[model samples]
Target chain A: MTETPVKVLVVDDAATVRLYHTSLLSEAGFAVEEAANGLEAVEAALTTAFDLFVVDVNMPKMNGYTCVETLRSETVGTPAPVLMISTEDRPGDAERAYAAGANLYMVKPVSAERLVRVARMLTAGRGIPA
Target chain B: MGLVRRNTPPPEETAAPPSADTLLSQLDDPDPELRREAALGLDGSAEAVAPLLDRVAGETEAAVRDAMLTTLAAHDTAQVAEGLAVHLASDDAGLRTAVAETLATMPNSVPALLPRLIDDDDHDVRVMTAMVLADLPHPEAMTWLAVMIREDPHPNVVTAAIDALLPSIGPEHHELLRGAVERFPDDPFLRFTVEAAVK
Candidate 1:
């Protein structure tokens, strides 16, 4: 029996970044979905079941922190691991991400290898194709 | 009985509109609605630029901020552009977006300040400015974007410039895109973006 691919929702306001992350993950055999902002990410989370969320910190309508909080809130209550990637590398940025229920926080320009490895580690045993 | 119309020149215009000073004070009112009204009332008052910018820095209410920004945008002066440009560094994403949106509308005023903003030490600010340039209707936007694509050191900021250039890409820009690819040879995303645009 062929198992379903692990699903990931990549949220970013920049279309190029979204396409880049989507392409990387798709090439790695994950079913990747894209959202332009936090509001859209929340909307997608409501109807779709994603195993992971790759969120960007700075976005219009709703930011990554608020989006992650909402996903963990009763409104959505998604238990999927959230990996927040942002250009903001201030002292408390990572702490803030964790406080908002993110499983991990990474800086921008995260290497392609690291991204795939971390994503695979986070979604381990979630039916990702071998 | 037959109706008779009596008009006495609308009560002789009893109350003159509030002065700019009066409206300026009202910006501090406890009621956000009053603050919004005050902002709107300050339109075309050049001296109000400083105070409106001060209010924007701390304004929590979105409606009031929008009102202030709208009032500022009407000025079309370098000071207004400079005042708005400072907020691009704000940590609040909503405020940053709002400021960018407001700045984009001031094509005449914002161009003078673009160089300094694009050269900001913070890469995020550069990225935001690049995005703003994409929406600015000024004729020089393409030149600014091409310079960024060829010279900006950061991949994210350069990527934003590349995205801005995509709408108007031409054969003339192919070499610039190739230069960007060469500048960041290891960045797959940048290379992919250049490939997509050149294709």
Candidate 2:
């Protein structure tokens, strides 16, 4: 049986940022879907069982914090590792992300190599059936 | 909360085209998807504008808000502009940016919304407001941005103002930019912007 590529959701409001992240992850053999904001991300999550979520913190409708909270809640509990990224480097932002169930919190303009390395490291053994 | 997807068939998609009343009621549906669908279903009904604007103001879901914004943008009315203006001060940067993008697309909407947005207590919102203005043909965005450079207390907002003002700067605005450079001597980026503006 062919091994299925790990699936990831790339959520951000900026079109350019979504494209950048999608390209990087697609190149690394991950199946990726894009959501323009947290609401879209949540809607997509309900229909799909993704292995990882690369979420942006400050989004309209629902923010990354609330999105993760919902995902961890009974609403769409997948327990998939969440990697929250944001332009905000404020002191409490990361802690809030962790408290909301994110596995990692990273600042924006994250280097491409590091992003891929981190994605790979985080999803190493978690394989979902296609 | 239990994640419940309301299994009821959407009223808007029922056999007959949904009446305005049915659509309006769906706006209050428990599912965000149903609310978003209701917002989209109200398109092209002039009678739907006021009710839609009211729903937009109370909308909590971003997807639903986006649907309502799309409907409002389709109709250029004072009420629509007023409805859009309130989101500029939203804590969610994405929502604020979405409202800005919507304003940029609707020319008439920009003027009415700018003053409040430029003066918003959140400097970040003001910064975003300036960024939206930068993309428009109206000089008012630049004009207010120049004012922001001089009067706005936050360096971030000022820097955003300078960035928006730079491409359109003229010799007539030299003194204003120079004053800004002097106002924040410690802001290297602002100094660089002013130097570029003067040049």
Best by TM-score: 1
- Report the error of model 2 at residue B197, Å: 7.5
Q: Is the docking of candidate 2 incorrect, acceptable, medium or high quality?
A: incorrect
Report clash pairs, candidate 2. Answer: A61-B62
The runs of at least 3 residues in candidate 1 whose Cα sits more than 4 Å from the true structure, single-residue gaps closed, are A1-3, B1-23, B30-47
Q: What is candidate 1's lDDT per residue for B25-70, written digit by digit as tens?
A: 9999999999999999999998889999998979988789889999
C-alpha RMSD over true interface residues, model 1: 2.0
Q: Give one digit per residue, the lDDT tens place, for model 1 in A5-120.
A: 99999999877788888988999999999999999999999999999999998776677888999999999999999999987776788998999999999987788889999999
TM-score of predicted structure 2: 0.55
Clashes of 1: 0
Candidate 1 lDDT score at position B139: 94
List all candidate RMSDs to the true structure. 3.8, 12.3
Model 2: per-residue Cα lDDT over B1-199, one tens digit each: 9999979966675487878899989989999998899889999878878887677657778789889889888886777777776776655445666777666666766788677777887765676676677676675667787888888877667766776676678998888878887787776546655665677
Q: Each model's C-alpha lDDT?
A: 0.89, 0.77
Report the alpha-carbon TM-score of model 1 versus the true structure.
Answer: 0.84
